[model samples]
Target: MARVMRDATVAATAEKIFAACGPSWLGDSYNHWSAAVKAWAVGATRSLPDDDRRAIVYKTQELDDALMAARRALEEEDDE
Candidate 1:
C-alpha cells in the first residue's frame, strides 16, 4: 500500500510538472501548479501510515526552491 501510494504520487507529480513546464500544454500556470501540487502531495502523504511525509515535503520544498532560483537567474539575465 505504501508502494502504491508512492507510485501514484510520483505519477501525479510528473503529470503536473509536465503540464506546468511542457510546451503546447493547457494547465494551471507554473506558480499555481506548484502550489496546487504541493498541497495535493501533502494531503496524499498524510494518508500514509509510515513516516514518508517528511521525505515528500522535503523533496517538494527542494524542487520549489530550485525552480525559484533558476527562474530568478533567468529573469536577471533577461533584464541585462
Candidate 2:
C-alpha cells in the first residue's frame, strides 16, 4: 500500500507535481508521488522564529522542486 507521509518537518503540494506534466499524464509519475510525500513535510516544518520558518520552508520547497524535476527527467527517459 502507498503510505502518505505525515510529519512536522515535511511539506509538499500535489498541485505542483500534477501541473509539471500538464493534465494529460499517461500514468502516475514520480513527481506526483514526490509532491504528495513532500507536501506534508513542508507543512509540518516548524521554527521558533518567523524568519527561521521562512528559511526552512523555502529550503523544503526547493528540495521538493528538485525532486519533482528529477522525476520528470526519469519519466522522459522511460518514455524514450
Best by lDDT: 1
> Which 10-residue span in candidate 2 carries the lowest summed lDDT?
1-10
Candidate that would win on TM-score? 1
**Tens-digit lDDT track for model 1 on 1-80?**
24434745654555565445443222324454445555566656356433344434344444555666787799999999
RMSD of 1: 7.8
Q: What's the CA RMSD of model 2 in angstroms?
A: 11.3
Off by over 4 Å in 2: 1-47
What is the Å distance of residue 5 in model 1 from its true position? 8.5
**Candidate 2 residue-wise lDDT, 1-80, digit = tens:** 22233333324333443344343332444444444445544655542343433433454455556666788999999999
